[model samples]
Target: MERDILHLTVPTFPITLARIAEPSLRERPVAVAPLTSERAVIQCASLEARAEGVCEGVSVY
Candidate 1:
């Protein structure tokens, strides 16, 4: 017998959910980061944000 498996991913899942909940977020640069830290890092960023140089692991200053 043989088995098969698949994997999937949404790079900007957090930003996607935010845009879904807030229609206004559509068509805008969006990024997800921690709010409780002085130096926060971007966990995920939308396409627009990425185009503007925002990306995961980048510090959000």
Candidate 2:
């Protein structure tokens, strides 16, 4: 017997949600980083940010 599977994902989920709440953030480089410090690690980055070389686990500073 064979089985089928489905996969779904929301890339840069936070940014997506933010854009939903704030229309201005749409199509912009949005990054979700720790709110504690300037050197805090990036938790997630939108496609626009990734194109600019920003990535998760990288320092926001």
Candidate 3:
């Protein structure tokens, strides 16, 4: 008996985290929130936030 493993492969399209980080976005907490003027909800949390139990789909109200 063998267990199945899920896998995915992408060709030609590559994303490297190191290249996307700017001086301000480096070595700090980062997240992608919805565009807003007032207090907006949290859409996704960064690696730092994940370490603190924050994650995607977390309500911010």
What TM-score fits each model? Answer: 0.79, 0.73, 0.45
lDDT of 2 by residue, 1-61 (tens): 9999999887678888889999999988889987878589988898898999998998766
Ranking by TM-score: 1, 2, 3
Write candidate 1's Cα lDDT for 1-61 as tens digits: 9999999898888888899999999999999999998999999988898899887999878
lDDT of 3: 0.54
Q: Residues 1-61, candidate 3, lDDT per residue (tens digit)?
A: 9999998753211212532745565545665556673656666556665777766665565
Lowest-lDDT window of 10 residues in candidate 3? 10-19
Better of 1 and 2 by lDDT: 1
Worst 10 residues of 1 by lDDT: 8-17
For residue 27, give model 1's deviation from the true position in Å. 0.5
Pairs with steric clashes in candidate 3: none
- Model 1 bad stretches (over 4 Å): 1-3
